[model samples]
Target: MTTTTENRHALPTGYQLQDYRLISIIGHGGFGITYLAKDTKLNHEVAIKEYFPNDLAIRENDHNVHPKSHQDKENFAWGLERFLQEGQTLATFQHPNIVRVLRYFEAHNTAYIVMEYEQGQSLSSAIKNKGTATEAFLLEIVSPLLEGLQAVHEAGLLHRDIKPDNIYLRDKDHSPVLLDFGAARYAIGSRSRSVTTIVTPGYTPFEQYQTKGDQGPWTDIYALGAVLYRIISDKIPVEAPKRVNAIKLREEADPLPPATKIGRKHYSERLLRNIDWALEIAEKDRPQTVSQWAEALLPPPSPTEQAKPVKPVNRITPATTSAATTRCGSTTAT
Candidate 1:
């Protein structure tokens, strides 16, 4: 994840450097390094995500070389295809709340994706900096996030990793933008026997931990619920309750702090109820689509409420102003 392009003969910095001027390092993760760079031709700042192709290729090679059986080789190939496919799939989505992928290419034996540079703190950082967000603020942030998820849902993409860390808040415009489509899976695709469980433990759905089953919108819904629960309670939900022999055991989950505790004083019961519904254990019991969950939290206005008549204000003219001025006796000489 090192951002230094100094030693990379394949990626030298200068007028001759590959189409971009590396400004500085931005962020780094296990997969690759992200650089805040300027597009030479476009003269716009962009985020350059350079994937560790060597690592991926090496990992693929290792899996092939040290396979326990012939089946292991097949599994390795499947995983490689999936990893590449994810990058291709993310390239297709174009939404305002979702980070835009400008370009995708390979250099120095590594694949790189150029994207919009989002200047903001992640949801995790906001929580850490502010301790806990107010209920209204949480709703403001989450509503837009859900809208972004809806776009992904419509595109047949399941964001397997939908956690606070992946939700960014842009300070410039005060809007939430979803990030990290690396773990996104296409709904309609060939099933590869690749068994890579890509998910964060507490934020991920229970079904994700299972070795088998098709992941879909419902799976993303579970993660969305987990994100909201954390924002509201400031406490991550405990792992899905486990069952014991002959009895279905469940642990007592922590209740959300009262609105009074946060000094909001008054709030809607329906909103809280919807939050709980989204966090339900059974996927079938939860809201099926992102839009459904969003609508539940943000219910439509009643017909009577919308039918209310509007009142017009009286107009103040120059004549009225002149009369008022005369009454005050503010004129000097003509």
Candidate 2:
């Protein structure tokens, strides 16, 4: 049998990985492959992510993943450990806006994270189908997502990758759920000589491209800011590297146009200003945390708005970041 990229790296349909039966491949990225699978024991669908960095490892005919070379073994094992760590950390949260990790385990010479399968189109698809999003629609999605992300940060972890495609809008309530965390990918890239820095061109900030970049809550803030820019302006912000290069040459202004200028008429001045603040080329200039940026993006509800009866479903509620840390992995529906 000839080996191609997808079939070579991905487990074939009907292949069983423990209790999960692979139905098909849903998505694949540089760090892993996400499969749509059925949990035979539970008799339900789930999304299982397998750690297989094609650059460092290859799938042998025996159906076990092995390092491409002896020199790559240490790096591959290090990344697998990090991948497992990410799943364990994520399994700690019970936030509604975050994707739920049901469990994680190791087999087939790699690791797998089983997450609750959500039915929805990605924010990228919604934007393409609906054109520019309304200020109301943007708030509905961003507010809840920020709370979820804040929880992740307070847990001493970072999502690292936040893009429209990584944000999913559930079909049931149109509520947003964050997906495809980049922590493992980012950690591996930082240490492995074979892998380059993990970045999504327009969404990644200037600092992410640097090996020793000072990343923190501010790093995620920049990526989320870029997501908002894409929604309101219907155009992606200029890539961060190009913007920084223009500054180095003593340019008078950033290569990317300010959100305030593009979204002023449709969105409030406060909203536009916050978007620009999040996308600041200098890390020092951006909002330092999710709460800080969200304050401006999401204002306090008015007396009348608060006085009204709150719907039991899909209403934004206040949550402390610490609360996210207290929960263990048992909250999702079976």
Candidate 3:
């Protein structure tokens, strides 16, 4: 992404004086700031993400800075389009494991996406509070996580950013809810002059470090593998090797630390193999679909655990209910 200098005079908290009642500041990032707000009409809490505009008007009015006359409008347009598109894309997804976008609107020259307010800790916080999660716990978390991704992949979208921070654990249902579709993209076409990288470095795919070409399911697979690695090893995968001097999987990349080292039994060889496959240098060699990865990780049902068949019984008589029992008793001589 085009690195713009931080706007020192820009508003730190992104709440306007009008419609939204800002509860508290939740988070901030390079592109925008998130706030916990209550919608006056609905009287319910929601997350309102305010997008920062790249336009000169925003710079001069909001930040007390000025952009040169020749500054590219393309960046502004791209940001606006992505901000709106993410809302539209997320609004269509109806899965319980994904955050639901309630509304999208532009006001005061800033775009906002209102979404369900989650009252639970993020995966990042969970990891911090308790060290590395146990294997069973990790599986419990990642299984539903993969299921959520399966929904996203089926919708023909890519969540370019998949990290602990973006994964929320809802206390109400005790299920994982994937959030922040801001960096998401439709995988069908190539993005133009967007010389910007949209994902975090260590969690991103090796190919994403390159300046050209579109990313697909393999990009997300690489990120998910990195996340799993960290949960299991309590260490982030070494920064995706440099693009120009990127190391191939078989050559210089380090072998993943064994699960046994982390106080867990050695996982099946197939599981380890698939994890390694996801971290492969070439996207083609990795599992092409999220469901494929899920299949590799999910254990098969046991024969001994199968449900027993119920034997069929011959009918003795037709059963009936009657209000007029006296007349029925009189006719029961047979």
Alpha-carbon RMSD, each predicted model: 13.8, 7.4, 15.7
Best by TM-score: 2
Candidates' C-alpha lDDT: 0.57, 0.81, 0.61
lDDT of 2: 0.81
When summed lDDT is taken over every stretch of 10 residues in candidate 1, the lowest stretch is 314-323
Off by over 4 Å in 1: 1-17, 53-84, 184-197, 241-267, 301-334
- Evaluated with lDDT, which candidate comes out highest? 2
Q: Write the per-residue lDDT of candidate 1 for residues 1-334, one digit (tens) a residue.
A: 1243342312323322378887766665444456778898989888876653222233232222222345544443454455456667677877667877877765544456788886666777666535445555656676667767777877777777788777766656556777776541211112332224355655666566555754677788777777776765667655553311112444433333432243233346666676667656567877887767766676454566446552222111101111111011111110
Q: Which scores better on lDDT, 2 or 3?
A: 2
lDDT of 2 by residue, 9-81 (tens): 8989899889999888877878899888999999999999999888889988888999988767877888888
Model 3 per-residue lDDT tens digits across residues 137-158: 6566676777678778878878
Q: Please give the distance, in angstroms, between residue 151's alpha carbon in candidate 3 and its true position after superposition.
A: 1.5
Clashing pairs in 3: 1-196, 1-197
Q: Rank the candidates by lDDT, best first.
A: 2, 3, 1
